[model samples]
Target: MLVPTAAGTPAAPAGSPADTAPSVSASTAVAQARSTEVEEQLARDPGRFRVLTGDRPTGALHLGHLLATLDNRVRLQDAGVDVVLVVADYQVITDRDDAGDLPAVVREVVLDYLAAGIDPARSTVFTHSAVPALNQLLLPFLSLVSVAELERNPTVKAEAVDAERRQGRGMSGLLFTYPVHQAADILFCRANLVPVGQDQLPHLETTRTVARRFNQRYAPTTGYFPEPEALLTPSLTVLGDDGAKMSKSRGNALELRASEDETVRFFRRARTDSERHITYEPERRPEVANLLRIGAHLAGTTPGELADAVGAAGAGRLKTVVTEAVVEGLRPLRERRAALAADGPAVVRDVLARGNARANEIADRTLADVRELMGTMYS
Candidate 1:
């Protein structure tokens, strides 16, 4: 059975949320209910909602991205929602100033999106740098949020701590206001639905706060900005081979670009318990359970079922099954990516060019509305 950690106690292991105590707060429950309502509304009339979600171009795409946001993005796009994907290239500097491989990483990210079924024709894909009007919303949005509120944001706090620990540098000012920037990303396009996990609720809440404050202050009756709703995703943490959060920098992740042989070798070396009898015990046997979870995700079954299938077969058999499942599951993506990559980065550039053009048109209109609302539209 899962146990809750006491106050001041260490956090539960990654991917084992049930082992941690539940807050069970009324506000949280309300948010969940609202998310459910938005989800149902979206299903009935997807044309009514616009979704804004993206990733920072830190590295190659991994399985973690697949199970988390990428798949959800595709699902939403297929449902006929207006999906706007931002390659958060500018946010990468919030932690480090490394632009050496930024361009390459951005191209790879676009390639990954295409390979994962985010049709360029159906969904808009653009970069942060290309959208100046979007960033302009930052100044006003920043004013809407106080320093205390920004600092209080758990996502910003955790990211700042992570950056300091990993890079041995203090958090950048941009990093401090990262949530506000995200608010801009969502509000600039007037996106009404944002796909987020529990950890990201703080950021989305901040966005909603900005929208509410702006409407109350300037566009009172107009309600110029829609307070975006969170489309909370099913929580399924995909840990790395080292039994921690799957990360590209940690070298424990299985990249979507990994070859079949690489996939096998990587999973073969995954950290697993020595017990010959396999069991799906996330609390006690996190690593084993993590593998089971990955295998089950790819095999379209529950982790318990995968564990039962691998019972007494040992970690070797389990690893083999998971690795093969991954290879088979990712075969189509790899093939499509290979074909897309053969065309070089030009194709991605063209897609971004088109996306940026479309985004600029939308941003210009949004900014015009903002200026008129604030009585600053002299032009």
Candidate 2:
């Protein structure tokens, strides 16, 4: 039986239709009402709904990252929502053997964000290591959660397995407890909304659980943290040239900063079946379908329409079409990135510095409140 969050009449056993009907109906009504309430709250003042989203900054941002998150972040910023983009620099060490010039990597990631239209004036972009309050929040959050609970997080488990395979070693204790750190990331900013894909629902649920537990234990009557709601976005699983998930480590990803010539060359070499005619059958022709999906995403059209447009054409023609669309679409972004690069590291540093100062101010207030509640504040 699914446990309820609030005190309510217990759900009847499955056999009794007469008793179960009202309970089911009431449960549905309550769920709908709560959803409506959240919607109203968001609609009333979009700016009041603080959104926290970020990347690990392990590598340069790629096209997959753009569609998966950066685009949505730009939309949210334009809609006047307070956006906090965390550069999760600390997480880069979780599975890797070497940090590898992290400062340079972080700078490149910031430039990619600016190139992809993330306006620094509108969104706060700060590094995770810049904020000391996060550490304080993380310690208490760790106590609230358990070893078993951390071990049970599906995301962490899957990542650990993958890390083990790559590193040929067991996961570190820090990697095991990364979810608790993520919870602190969200709650420290008091973020009310987090944009995530479906697969990330488990991570968000962990964050919600941490928030709820803290509020209940420390400030039962007046909640200190808002249990963040997941703002589900359309999943964009852009495959690499080899028909696997696009990843920097695999060297199959099309970086956001790829030059026009590089974009053309990469897609030209993308694997496609020996079919004489073009078609959109992802199950059987994933490589060709991957090209089609990339074109659709770039051209703002459906894969079916693209298939019809390229009907009876060979894979070479399809590649040509896809490459042109991708290159043309990315031209403006490339120009912007080039301009930002010409300005040097000073601009990126300034943007991050301002963001860090502002974020620290907000985080300090929240940490102060938390300390007062926990009786750690003595003046």
Candidate 3:
């Protein structure tokens, strides 16, 4: 039994609609107020700050991705943030045994970005492999951090263990040192802010450490790289149907581009307990709670509110409601995706090419400055 917060709210059990409603209203109001504050903050001088965020091109974007980070990116862009969205094609091979259909996967990722409301004209969207300077910066960045330091990164260790468990083998050297490469990705663009979830704080800290060390060693008078800060999102942890963290390989993800039938089938098959009543007791009933969270996110309300609205409705009714809300919420995105897909790959290629050119120009200037700082700019 998870204890409630300072608000004296307990977990809504099977027959406690009265206790749940006020808590729901209070939580929803707080969340709304905080969101408004963030929006107000972003609206002021977003153009002065450079923000970099991205995803590994392992597959298309999913509902979890949208709730966790993509939505924040869109908001930032709309508020005039200088946004650079990276499709990390190179990182796909870091832990995986195989890079599956790299080109097709990358293109699909871009389409998903476009569908998710990332305007290419507003936000620079480029593939990691297309930016040569990013790779070039990695050599020097790697030298700044030690093997022990790399091995100690919690994100790298967790990812390596998961990969080895899946593949039944050990990870490669590249997988172990991937965080250093990530540092290069951030510093190369001189991005001042990186939007990330709480679980990714360790990686962002590593990036900050690398930036600080590089500046102190090379250019103490004036810092060459900005010590990028993590813009931690409030709703970062989105669980999958199995009550575990949402991931593509788990086969529990709700893909953003999933068909109407597929979406229905996915939610219909969601795992809930034998107890019929829908309640918001995550610690005790995670599967059903996960569905409630998804539904609340889609319906623009709190999970407690959603549960109260359903009253004593059983799991079947809850599932139906969640499925409808998800389908309806994703309708516009799906329509946009279909229209973009119909335009074929040429349009996506053009967007990527233009973004790549812009990224290259900025990266080149940064690299030139780094070389000059290190006294390696002979020509």
Candidate 2: misplaced stretches above 4 Å? Answer: 1-45, 159-168
Candidate 3 lDDT (Cα, 0 to 1): 0.78
Model 3 Cα lDDT, one tens digit per residue, 193-260: 77765556668767866776676678665556766666657755567767677898887788899998
lDDT of 2 by residue, 69-184 (tens): 88889878888888999999999888777999999999999999999888889899999999999767888898877787787787677876786677458787778999888998
Rank order (by lDDT, best first): 1, 2, 3
lDDT of each: 0.85, 0.81, 0.78
State which candidate, 1 or 3, has the greater TM-score: 1
- The candidate scoring highest on TM-score is 1
Q: What is the lDDT of residue 198 in candidate 3?
A: 51
User: Mind giving the per-residue lDDT tens digits that candidate 1 earns over 1-379?
Assistant: 1111111223223235422324537546756887888777777888878889999999989999998889899999999999999999999888676766889999999999999999989999999999999999999888887888887888677876787677457778998999899999998998888888777787887887787777767865546787777788977788887778999878889899989998988898889988999999998998998889888888899999999999999999999999988999899999999999999989999999999999999998988889998999786
